[model samples]
Target: MTEAPSPAPVRIRPEIAALPPYRQGKQAGADAFKLSSNENPFDPLPSVIEAMRSATAVNRYPDASASRLRARLAARFGVGIDGVHVAAGSVSILQQLALATAGAGDELMYAWRSFEAYPGLAAVAGATAVPVPLAADGTHDLDTMARRVTDRTRLILVCSPNNPTGPIVRQDDFEAFLARVPADVLVVLDEAYAEFVTDPAAVDGARVLADGHQNVVVLRTFSKAYGLAGLRIGYGVGHPRILDAARATGIPLSVTAQAEEAALASLDAEDELIARVAVITDCRDRLAAGLRAGGWNVPDAQGNFVWLATGEQTLEVAPRFEDAGLVVRPFAGDGVRISVGEEASMPAILEAAASALSLLPEGHPARAM
Candidate 1:
């Protein structure tokens, strides 16, 4: 028999070991209401499910390029086919971008605590991470971010309608921010929650790209808005040459034929799917208003969820939420982020928020400064 390797002999990369693992949603039991992970609560579209069922070509590998999905996306975005490349998910695409572009003494800049993966991806790719702090309003401090940029900075990430902090960077501000930054550095506008936004001035990465900016690449996924969290499909669009470069590096990484079929069907049902998003937008607004009424530090969110800027207060009150059968997302020391799903998680969540207000320690900041 082949000998089993000793644990000590496995000289793994220290950077990998030093990394804090990504925290997923908490699981209570079979009947728990999980609002922890920001996934859409709806079932997959009938069209999407049917596509998956018909895609039984499990005998073969997926197309490395994911051409059909790309074509569909191009039509939707009104971009050339060469401008899009689909991958396992936007998070996967982000990691690959960090590897392919930013590395070896280069610096990767992004808002602090925006996406946990930013630093991990930077470390794995042998790059320096410079985390710019968010504004007191819990939005990207674009001016400060622009000031923090240096020649060594190889990549800049802008998360519109930022996760955990629901502020959308205004388009005019981003255009100015884009103007200030050096073009050599690849700027990634992560629009994972793009479909949920209803703000008039919100920075739309697609519109920005269509404006003919060369180095700006936009990342989006089917996980959130499309209700396809299980599929792990995402794409990026940019200058054809730049996107093509990212594509060339993304070979051998894609979903099965089943995933492709489902994605195609999802595209066909976009109008219906978007109508579903309208409901989520409503929920987001109602919850934000409700949280404010209960005396929590809730922001004016534009995405599918509202965030509690309660800081340490969240830690103290998180258990109360658990007791109410609502699983909320708490970032240990930073704050709490809750995903607004259906009417079910709301009553329990609101009750928990009320309890949280009373249970929290004195002198905790009640709202964002």
Candidate 2:
């Protein structure tokens, strides 16, 4: 008993100990519409389900390299198989890229209010995270970002249609910024919601690559538009050397054979997926328009969600929506992100928004101009 009592506590990294684990969007009750996670609202296609079922190898390990999926993505993007990498999700690949490039005494830069995973990923890599603030309109301030880069900067994440805020990085603007960055620094264009983007002016990663930007990587996911969130498959396209680094750092065999089959089936049914995306985009437009009419300062909203600048009222208003049977993601000091989910969820969402707007203090940014 005395020997057991003498055992000391285990030591852990202080920075990691202080950091919180990634918090997913809140789940809703059975009667509630969960628009919190920015998940695709559509059910998986029947063919996709069949393909997953056909991948009946629970006892065996998946392709460690996800070679087949990589080849398919390579063909689609006009890249060599070596230029593509797949993972349980694009976010996982992102963490791998950060691990491969940055470490203790290094820096990873990204815009603030971006995908919530960035800061944590950098921290886990023992790298310093430098977050540049977005402009008041909620778009990345790329010019400021370039000036902030230093010799210590190893990686930079540019989340197009920046998550939680939804305004995409314009194509011309991004290309110019890419020109400003040093070639040695890795630049990742995270386009998780790319399929939902209707803005013709937004950055198209493939086009950027074709233009000979070698240091840039484009991350895409099957989770959103393809309705494969549960399967968790995503990919990245970049130079072979860069992708090889990512693959080297990745968790072995994380992408399941079932996930790969589902993704392949999803590609086979791309036409139907595109049609579903159109429906979601339509719903997003209607929701944004409704919010704007009710005095909310909705942004460009190029993704499948709308941003509400509730400012200090964020915490106050979020509960109202939750109580109203519509769950949304609220960033305390910033605003709320409402995903474009089921068509039937819209009325509840609109009603909750109108009520929340009414409750805001006079002249709040979320108020109608």
What's each prediction's TM-score?
0.94, 0.97
Give candidate 1's TM-score.
0.94
Superposed Cα deviation of residue 369, candidate 2 (Å): 1.7
| Model 1, C-alpha of 260: deviation from truth (Å) | 1.5
Weakest 10 consecutive residues of candidate 1 by summed lDDT? 360-369
Top of the candidates by lDDT:
2
In model 2, the Cα lDDT at residue 99 comes to 98
For model 2, residues 1-369, the per-residue Cα lDDT tens digits are 355333228887878877778889999999999999999998888999999999997999988988888889999999899999999999999999999999999999999989999999888999999999999899999999999999999999999989989999999999999989999999999999999999999999999989999999999999998998988999999999998898899889999999999999899999999999999999999999988887788988988999998888899999999999988999998899999999999989988998888778888777767
Off by over 4 Å in 1: 1-8, 251-253, 367-369
Which residue pairs of candidate 1 clash? 88-232
